[model samples]
Target: MSTLLPISAKTPAGRPRGDGAETAQGLTPAQMARRMAGLEGLVWLDSSRPGEGALSMLTALPCEVLAGRMDTDWQRVEEELEAGQKAGLAGGLFGWAGFDGRFVLGVFPHALVYDHDRRCWFDSGGLAARIPAVAAAAAGSVPRLDFSPQVRREDFLSQVRRAQELIAAGDIYQVNLAHSWQAAWPRGADALSAYQRLRRVSPAPHAAFLDLAGVTVLSASPELFLKMSGREIMTRPIKGTRPRFPGDPARDAASLSALLASEKERAELLMITDLERNDLGRVCEYGSVRVDGLWEVESFAQVFHLVSTVGGLLRPEVSHAAAFRACFPGGSITGAPKKRAMEIIQELEAAPRGLYTGAVGYFGFDGESRWSIAIRTAVREGERVTFHAGSGIVADSVPELEWEETLHKAAGLLAAWSLPR
Candidate 1:
């Protein structure tokens, strides 16, 4: 996989130029592998637990880094959405040489450094340009993991019930619950193929995978982290969810409407919104936190969702890292009453989320950038493939409905697996 992506250093240095957003290249699996040749990078895929230190540890790695960012020009995004545009402008954040603080990217669909001569990927020692690929990993490797699948579901849920008890005793309104899957893949399978196949079933606005350090951060995320272009930074956190029906659209729409109107759904959305507002408040100029849109229901192939967009202006000197730090592990994917919910979810769920609910993206070393929450992804190593799907289980959340929601989230990966639909 690393051979195709040749990381070739420029013989003569010139000012790095910017390229606008590039769509995922419709290439074959072999093509993707060939692209990962000789390159050095450190990729980190982590669920949004602010305390976890993965992002911080990633930035401090001893290698050139490129991060994806979308917190730029929120105004332009609206225009594009209203106009029915297929995409928007984006860039890469890089840290190189003596220019340690900035990076450059021109909205390429996928970026990488290839061997100068072979035009293939460069993995060995050599100076090369930096690039970002919405999809990446050695031939078949995936993010490293320390999985605990034997945990009992009942025990996990009991922990969550305990947390709910705690929330009731406090002023917290809602929380999101989750489970994770963890394993390691070293040049094992094709991630982009999996992503393209997954999109056929569950397409989302935000998705990415990073191969950095010694691990590959795999993600098929559905949530947006933080996006920055110039002074504008925006986050669209997905809070409420309903499962998809295999039978009819009318029935699905009805279910979706119920989700849209449900009190539990609204509470979950509000919890994340409040969390995001606080995050933005950290770096945003005072009075910049605003809910541009809220409780907007968007439909995927398998389900309906209540998603909200919140944003703020970055303080003139504030760095993108600070903005993300304020709202790591996006509020939507994580249960509300944030900290307590995570504790409950972790304790209740049987599997480790690994890169499941974690953020996958690039940050701009050149200017501003964006990050996407990893969800609906499948991990492949050797002959085995593992994929996960989950939903927020609130007080009113039905066990059946929540169970079905997990199926809905898994629809994309299942379809990607080519199981009989």
Candidate 2:
């Protein structure tokens, strides 16, 4: 079992930090690793920053990192995870494994944790002692960077048309296609700062900053891939998008209203929503899977999305790994008839999606977890940063319109990277 410790009212980073609306501040995992030395496998999920919303942080290091391929026996992986949890693993596990481990399987971290929501910290041992300094440290500033689209507008349009042809042939109903934008940052670039700027412009409920070893992922996604509490599980998938007009209030309202009324967009969202229901039904208890919400338009900094919620009750015998595996690479991003859509995507897309379509969040030791669909996210390595944006394609979708939708989605992250510091 883990221990929950209380932190004194001492201010961190010179700010009067209390349990109020003050922005929660903490070091990025990379920043913490640099300062703490010997912290290679550290994992920290910080939401203490105000406006960033939640004031909770979960931090730890893995006793060992686990790796598996998409073809790896999921049953076995679930067994390992069950054993670890049964052993009373201390900290929650965090990961961004590709759609399947065909790319990589994320590892679980074990150590001290600070649960701001609970007003206490947890660790199996003395790891909780280090939370203070890590929380108190200041975040570095983001350096100015430049990004170039890997897929030119014309090329993206051509791909959209190709997808429509596939849909016309009755090959697939919808397929989500994406393009990448990349930049190279010199050492000392601040990913956390970039994430903060993104949140300021487009606050998302699923915003996350993940530092996995040397790689850091900054996301401002508005979609929830999965959320678990005991046997209840839910997924909120977003299928349609419309850019938010900032200059005119009347136009913005009309644009949102139009998006809400778009039959094509509603068709796109419903297809994915039904696909999600099927995916959830696989692992959920019999008759437990159902659509909770549908055709709801939610606004964000960059765009508005038609969102829906699908939920189910997990079987008593189902494991967390099983519940998540059934919904890997969220349906919102993959499109309807999940497998066929992925096949078309793999055939037409110029590059591997890597973590863009993956999920990020913590698999807690206490049988609860929260994961955000990894969209509107940037991945940073030493000096290079890459992120992607995509749109769903249905038979009636116009090539040029779908192309523009992707650009609208990419706008905020591009601004975050290109904006002058």
Best by lDDT: 2
- Full-model lDDT, candidate 1: 0.50
lDDT of 2 at 250: 90
Tell me the TM-score of each prediction against the true structure. Answer: 0.64, 0.85
Compared to the true structure, candidate 2 yields what TM-score? 0.85
Q: List the global CA lDDT of all models.
A: 0.50, 0.71
Q: Residue 233: error of model 2 in Å? A: 0.9
Q: Count the backbone clashes (under 3 Å) in each candidate.
A: 89, 8
Off by over 4 Å in 2: 1-39, 42-55, 73-77, 100-127, 132-138, 419-421
Q: How many clashes would you count in candidate 1?
A: 89
Q: What is the C-alpha lDDT profile of model 2 across 34-95, one tens digit per residue?
A: 34333444444444232422434445455554555646655655766677678765455566
For residues 173-230, what per-residue lDDT tens digits would candidate 1 score against the true structure?
5655554433343354455444444444454555344444334334556577777766
